[model samples]
Target: MTERVCVGAIAGAFGVRGEVRLKSFTSQPNDIAAYAPLYTEDGSRSFTVRLTRPVTGGLGARLSGVETREQAEALKGVTLWADRDKLPALPDDEFYHADLIGLSVHDTGGALLGKVRAIYDHGAGDILEIHGPGRRRVLLLPFTRAFVPTVDLAAGRIVADPPDEQE
Candidate 1:
């Protein structure tokens, strides 16, 4: 698991001011500001986020040191990361996306499946994208208890009972 987890991103300037259009990835969108001093991916820069208002696609926010529209625009698409220790701890059933990514996956019978490449949440629920050797395409597995029975983070593997592939 990484020490820093991505919590939000700058989606360009909100208006003529220094405020930015912030797309938060937190479970509670507004909670993104609570984790202040968010850092850049490389740890070269950090910012204190102050949300201004709820915007169309995301929240409008002002970032520390971003005093001009040009500066906010320049930060577009920059993902903001928060230290893992600053975030709330989850229950046993919950897992952070950073911790799940790259975990080796296996079937109930112990056959190697693939590694988790990414996770997506599209209204219904979260989906796990798995990729492995010899696979022509990636496998999109629904991240449900019935399909993914076990996630042994300590062992760094997942045991799944995925549905039969169509092809």
Candidate 2:
């Protein structure tokens, strides 16, 4: 399958008439529906979203082919994907979470720290979860210029300046 980016997720049924609760991952939440014909993770099904109203935690939307509350409820927690090419290009300082995962990480002194396993954005900022080989623990490095001086996407590596030992 070609490259795809996760743009939104179904949070379950919103009302009794088949409307669904959607949590968008895009910068502009409403833009999730603009990328029409979003596909499921496995590409088994596709949906054309029409956002109806804003609801708590997400937006109320209607998906094509989903005509009943039961059908919408069944798709709870399903992540919506869009073709990478269809999405707008990001700026130099911005990056897609998919692009950062799996990239190797190194300290300022060129020591191998770990590889990026995941990225999380909990309102404040994005955090890079890095784990080294044979290690069970992970380092949650904030994706800020202070800690991460360089992000070499071309080289598939990041140069981080981790803080001193924890007190």
Candidate 3:
């Protein structure tokens, strides 16, 4: 796997001074700046983020080479990446979404279910999306211990004990 990790996204321009609306993915929002020189998905472009101030959704940031609203807007929707090593080490129970990607998911019975497709955070909390065969579907599993008791990064898999079927 590559060392690139997504840390945030550009949400269009914030002002006429090249400041762009930044939506950081860090738990400590300001840490986005600490991971300087973020890169685009393909590594073709990079940026140094300087948070100018707080905004409703995230932060207003200045990109190193961007100097206009138009330029900033052009970067909207671009996810910024940083070297994985640059990120602070997480605690034992904590895991970075980037690390979960591509991890195989299986039931307690040792049956293969799917692989992690994406992690979603819609304000409330994080949800794991698993993609796989007959069980191949995006299951919005709550990222809590009770829901997902085990995540073995070393084994490259997750043990999901889904809730009892209501139907």
Measured against the true structure, the TM-scores of the candidates, in listed sequence, are 0.97, 0.94, 0.93
**What order do candidates take by TM-score, descending?**
1, 2, 3
lDDT of 3 by residue, 1-167 (tens): 45988999988888788889899899999999999889999999988877899987889888899998888888889999999889988899998898898898888898887888999989888899877766534567888888888999999989998776432
lDDT of 2 by residue, 57-106 (tens): 99999999999999999999999999898899988888889888999999
- The local distance difference test score of each candidate is 0.95, 0.92, 0.87
**Clashing residue pair totals per candidate (backbone < 3 A):** 0, 0, 1
Point out where model 1 deviates above 4 Å: none
- Candidate 2, which segments miss by more than 4 Å at Cα? 134-136
- RMSD per prediction, one decimal? 0.8, 1.7, 1.6
**Which of the predicted structures, 1 or 3, would earn the higher lDDT when compared with the native?**
1
Distance from true position, residue 93, model 1, in Å?
A: 0.4
Top-scoring candidate (lDDT): 1
RMSD of 1: 0.8
